[model samples]
Structures are given as C-alpha cells and as structure tokens.
Target: MSATQMDMLWMAYGKAGAVGSIRHEDDLFHVVMSDRREIGAYPTLEIAKGALISHLKPGTDRPEFRRV
Candidate 1:
C-alpha cells in the first residue's frame, strides 16, 4: 500500500510539551527531536519510538509518550 505524507509522519508528545517526531522516509524511520535534532534512523517504527522514549526518559520504568 502507498502511504500518504500524513501517514508517514508520527508525533510524540510528553507531559511537559512536544517531545519529537518519527518520519518514515527512504524505507527508514527517522527520529527527530523537538529542537530539530536528528537522532537516528531505525528499520522499524517501533524501534524508532523506543529510541525516542529512551533518550527522553532514561532509567524510568514507565515513560509516558502520547503518539499523535
């Protein structure tokens, strides 16, 4: 299936404010922070999401991240 631009974009939000976003491009999931910093690219969206969570909240059991 062909994914639209909107479908390729995923935003991650935290309790304080906007955390970051994950964009699917060139068959890779790119994790970009709120400050416009490119974290890294992952093979899957799940992995990309986890990287964001880990970077934001390290050593936390339950790091809350609202996907938008």
Candidate 2:
C-alpha cells in the first residue's frame, strides 16, 4: 500500500465537541474509531469519507481525537 493508503483514521475532536476525521485512501480499507466502534466497511476509503465528514466538526481547535 502507498503512503496515501490510510492504515489508521481518527476523529479528531476539539473544544465543545468539534470533530473531523483524518482521511487517506488506498485500494481498500476499513474505518474504525478508537472506541472500536465500526465506522462501517467500505471497498474504498473515498467511499467511506462521507461517513467520516458526518462524524466530524472541522471548525475546532484541538489535537487529535480528544475531548477538550
């Protein structure tokens, strides 16, 4: 797998519950949270991005998947 292929993904959260998912793509992947909740299985990372965005709030100031 190339560098673009994400081996891991996380929903980085910020103050007041802001969230956004780190994205990368490869030939195939399965996205899951730190909590181990399955984000669903997709044939491609691009296809799963919609779900990632839905679970994220891009306008926050926090580092990684933390609830500050």
Candidate 3:
C-alpha cells in the first residue's frame, strides 16, 4: 500500500516494554510511549525511530513499529 502523510506513528507493547513511535506533529517529531509519555523530541523521524529501536531488546519480544 502507498504510504500516506497522515499516518499515525505508534509502537507495540512487548514483554519487556512498549516501543512507542516517533510522532510527527506540530512540525516536530517525538518518541512517545504507549502510556502517553513523551521520551524526547527528535529532529527527524529516522532519529526518533533509531532511538526507539535502541531501547528495545534483541530477543523474541522485540518492539513492533506501526504506521497504519
């Protein structure tokens, strides 16, 4: 499917923790958790995505990223 500009960025909850998404809003991007908590604001979506992945474990319960 074609990616839309209005896509909602969010993360999936795993056994260890929830890997939230890098939200693009207000002309800015941020890595937010599922608990409605903002980790930090990143300049680009790549940066934010990298940050989230860094927090995830490399085991079976890996964090799932969603933008649909």
Candidate 4:
C-alpha cells in the first residue's frame, strides 16, 4: 500500500491526542507515537495501525476518517 494509506491506518488506531510519524532506522520505516504520556514504538506499520484501531472507544470521533 501507499505511504499515505499506511499513515491513515495508523492514525485510526492511535489513542486520543496521539500523533504518528515515519522514521527511518536501519533501512526500515518505523511507526512511532505517544500514548497516554508514554511513547509507543512499533516495528511494523501494520501492528501500529492495528493497535490504534483496537483501543478506540465506541462512538469516538474519527475526524481524520470523516466519521466524526
């Protein structure tokens, strides 16, 4: 998938107020974010994206997805 698609997925699963960015280390793209005042680092973009979505509360506003 495209980088933008991956970013969107990551944002969807991230916690409230979380922000994500792509960082390169050792020739790999890492997805990292802040969660509850702690930093969460994911080895794979897919995992990071999943974590964000899985923890979301019901009826949460997803403005990024236009579901607000």
Candidate with top lDDT is 1
lDDT of each: 0.77, 0.50, 0.65, 0.43
After superposition, the stretches of candidate 4 with alpha carbons farther than 4 Å from their true spots are 1-36, 59-68
lDDT tens digits by residue: candidate 3, 1-68:
23454445666556666656676765557787666667787777777777766665565455656664
- lDDT (Cα, tens digit) per residue for candidate 1, span 1-68: 35563348888866666778888888888999888989999988899988888777665353344545
Worst 10 residues of 1 by lDDT: 59-68
Question: Worst 10-residue stretch by lDDT in candidate 3?
Answer: 1-10
lDDT of 2 by residue, 13-39 (tens): 545443444444454445554355557
- Judged by TM-score, which candidate is best? 1
Which residue runs does candidate 3 get wrong by more than 4 Å? 1-7, 12-18, 57-62
Model 4: per-residue Cα lDDT over 1-68, one tens digit each:
55544433323323455444434344344444434422345676555455544445676554232111
Better of 2 and 3 by lDDT: 3
User: Weakest 10 consecutive residues, lDDT, candidate 2?
Assistant: 59-68
Q: List the candidates ranked by TM-score, beginning with the highest.
A: 1, 3, 2, 4
TM-score of each: 0.74, 0.38, 0.55, 0.34
lDDT for model 4, please.
0.43
Relative to the true structure, candidate 4 has a C-alpha RMSD (angstroms) of 6.9
